[model samples]
Target: MKTYRDYDDLPKIELPYGKEVSISDSTLRDGAQMPGIVMRSKHKVQIYEYLHMIGIEKLETFVYNERDRKAIKLMQDKGYEFPEITGWARANPADIDMVLNVDGIEETGILMSVSDPHIYDKMKLPTREAAQEKYLNALQYAVDHGLRTRAHIEDMTRADNYDFVFPLVEKILEIDPDCTIRICDTIGYGIPFMNVDEPYGIPTIVKYLKNELGAKNIETHCHDDFGLAVANSLAGYWHGANWSNVTYLGIGERAGNAEMEKLLVFLKRRIKGFEKYDLSCLVEFAKFMEKEIGIRIPRNKSVVGQNVFAHESGIHTAGVIKNPFTYEPYPPEIVGGQRNFLIGDSSGIEVLKFKVQETLKEMMDVHIEVDKNDKRLRNIQADIQRLFNEDERVSCISDEEIRAYVKKYFMFNPIVDQELHRREDDESPDNTI
Candidate 1:
């Protein structure tokens, strides 16, 4: 049985035993920040249901306005135990109050811009120390108001982990021991390889947070500027982080956040204790995002794309028809997708035979097996090839088109054949006498 392998030569890091690894979704908050995305109250509610149905542990949302509050209330009405709805707010008293005003939200992510560029340039703070003090005060206020805090160290990959990031996180832990420290790679500059230096090394950052700071709960919040969001997030989990912050379809600012569907599939395949997740709804969720919410999901996107399980080439379709595992990594049904053997210019006799048999069985309640070398099957294949070759068709032949070809070539109707055979038997010489 060939399976995925983890060799000893690789830079290996094990998650600490007894720690719980879970996913926190930000599709409602960060994902909505994607330009041109308008997640109205109803959209938020539907997305929430899909996330919950797929087994996300937490979902963070913005609580700045009446619409946000109403959406939160609507999601909360369902009373799901997992995917505990949380709030995202800046490190200010006003933002904290907005979170507190919500009825069921008990925990909220407090934004702390840890990178020097964010502090000195974006925020125009006097110094890093001033920013640290302000952030600590906000965290203290949120804790004082009886709300659990998740200190989001925004842009941690570009910050001085020792001088600013570490010390600030240490102080945050001191304030709220149970607080989850979300290490944000806001610019997607994080590298997954081990032995890399800080501010870019995700494994190093997560290790220090878990081993050095004694942080109980750590979350990895990554972006995809350099396309390292998923890799960096996995690195955080491999080193010791317990939570991975994600958005559905990886929809967010810039290149977007780590895709929840991709991460879930990876975790289920590589790690233990992830067998509880029901991923069958992944494709449906992607369709909803594309059709209802107006998000454009690439057709080749992993796990939940239309082309993920579609086979088109001659050799590929033949192999899939013989054994699906030959061409597919996993069963399409696992992700709520069906196998599609597409007939294009590259399709071969084997695929045509399979299609002909299937079409016959479906259209006429007759099961007629045709060999790959059968003349009727060959004629149908040639006609399909002519459409692409002579007619210059560029698209795969649709099933309906294939059924028409089956009707044209295989003209033997089972009912008519049975009637003709009965007449022949009745007209035999012994019966006539």
Candidate 2:
């Protein structure tokens, strides 16, 4: 059968042996950062457990700051089920100390500004070398404490100094070969579509880092400024990224982080052999998050979008009714969604008949076959179609109304037709044939 393995010839890299790519969720931290929303420690633990249940490999549970120390301590004491619980921090020992003090955070990530803009304009650093020292010092502190560190290269997309960025990554790698380094698009300013001249596209960056820094330890962290976070994250996975970072629903600063849903859909459905992920709990987690965070998922967003499984077009609805693959990328039920028929102007006669029949069958507990050519059904359908065309308020027509129309025009009540027959009697002709 066709599977992700069939695309072996394409530029693909394995996520790992058990799975091809690692699924990471940052909802607890980045997702909580959505404006005016707060998930208490109890809710935090709940989300953490849900993500772990869904088989997300890494959970960046919290940022190590004084303000969040109490919550982090609670989670640590609870002993969340995730194998890897990572702490986010600035590229400073003080920030790392906040997590190290939390009792049970084993893995750590520290981000440092890489672009010259931050160095020259923001921090007033004299030159790139001085900035490199500051970044390297912070990484060394995490290493000295025996923490498995993932150094985040910040503002990589806008950085004018790859010369500095590459050397900085090399410096951190030299200190600890086991240390993982991530290329971050800090201001949400990266693009996924490959361009020949500039090769910071996630895949290109992964390739460069792997060729120079080694693939065994390269990771990626993306933001969704231009709405390419999922694409960029996948590109990194395609090239060679063992670890990736994401937030649920891509909720973070500005546009947000990469959403775990989009990435997993591409991995589980589009890519084969990476099937070790237990996605049964995906929908539950997404719904829990939507309710907790108060953000309604967009209809056409993708993967978990409500309308992803909804069919509307006459041809598309007809084809999907026969076989979902005619229009769907995969069965909607696979992602915790059921196929839905969206009644619209583009609906065909078959759709109207099918909907009516299905409704009638359910209502009467018997099979119903609607004849599209039946005068009563045809006239009602025409009226319904015209009504929908004029007003968008109505989509579903009740079975009671349908039954009423059928009884009034198609069943034992033939008064309307009999009256018309009386009016036409003068023109009637005798027929013996």
Candidate 3:
């Protein structure tokens, strides 16, 4: 269920979305390409399995090496419950042949370097001729092999204008319009500049392509040389791009590819009239990747971060105490996270009182009137805050403990002196302050 209150009440924008932006996690392949990164075949298999359980609609299993191809084949033979399996390849017949020989990868993406520099420097050919030939040949190869094709136009941000890309896409469509097209921000060079105040705009240049292309299959591949890759991906979807090439924790070449977790949350919360994707297992998958793959998730990283749900401001805490929605944009519980109230020396007494009251209420079903001048309650609150700050402990006192302590203090004002070194034990009748 949608946890945010305003999701349904959001004002409708009649922006035409072409193909649904499907996710393709490339954790095994592209994620492995990052320097000093490697995954055991078993872990790779687990990643694929977990992706399906998380409701990722597609899986691009990276380059088709013998070991990788074997893994993809096993998944195909085993019949994954979700994520239609696919592989990535250079825009060449040999590459396509590698994927075709895999026997069960339902789709294969052929990455063609369509930019002028790549054409001239890498391929030693003119942009137009090299692009058309590579794209056409790769498409035909995949088609003849009975595999769906995704034509990856690499370095598209720097590629010669739509005049080149559009024609190439048109020709590929002429051969097979059903083939998916990947508009890559290879260097993260594509800037969606809006007005001066909002320099980063939406329905980006890539989005415009997907919009113009309409239903002729499209996807997105982005790099984060600049930090705008995620923003670009979101804008792409809002405009029209349907397929998102992603990696675990955004791990890939350079700054990495689009973050799969960030994309899932954005779609779940931001998109209108969009449904049918399951995301409950995303946090579990992220934790697995962190533990097994050794990718350290930053504390401030989006939904799955260590501190994403941690709150500390007094005003924010008080508002949250009233209604979490007042301070939080969305309920942390929606993403398998809980709201945290961190008390410290800077926290005011009112906030501290509310925190203790809230903790007591949660710990027990009883209601006790706390006096402001009660020195014992003040000391307990101070201890609670101290313990929380120094050792990260919160509310060590249980309901029974609270009842026993509060009843003893309120009824008899137990300890006669403030400086008494008291060690009370609940389990033993003789052990007391």
Best by the TM-score measure:
1
Any runs in candidate 2 off by more than 4 Å, and if so which?
Answer: 1-19, 63-80, 193-199, 389-433
Superposed by TM-score, candidate 2 places the C-alpha of residue 81 at a distance from the truth, in angstroms, of 3.7
- Residue-by-residue lDDT tens digits, candidate 2, 45-68: 777676766677777766645446
Model 2 clash pairs are 4-272, 15-20, 15-21
How many pairs of residues collide in each model?
0, 3, 1
RMSD of each: 4.5, 4.8, 6.9
CA lDDT, every model vs. true structure: 0.88, 0.72, 0.69
The order of the candidates by TM-score, greatest first, is 1, 2, 3
- Candidate 3, residue 83: lDDT: 79
lDDT of 3 at 26: 74
Worst 10 residues of 1 by lDDT: 4-13
Better of 1 and 2 by TM-score: 1
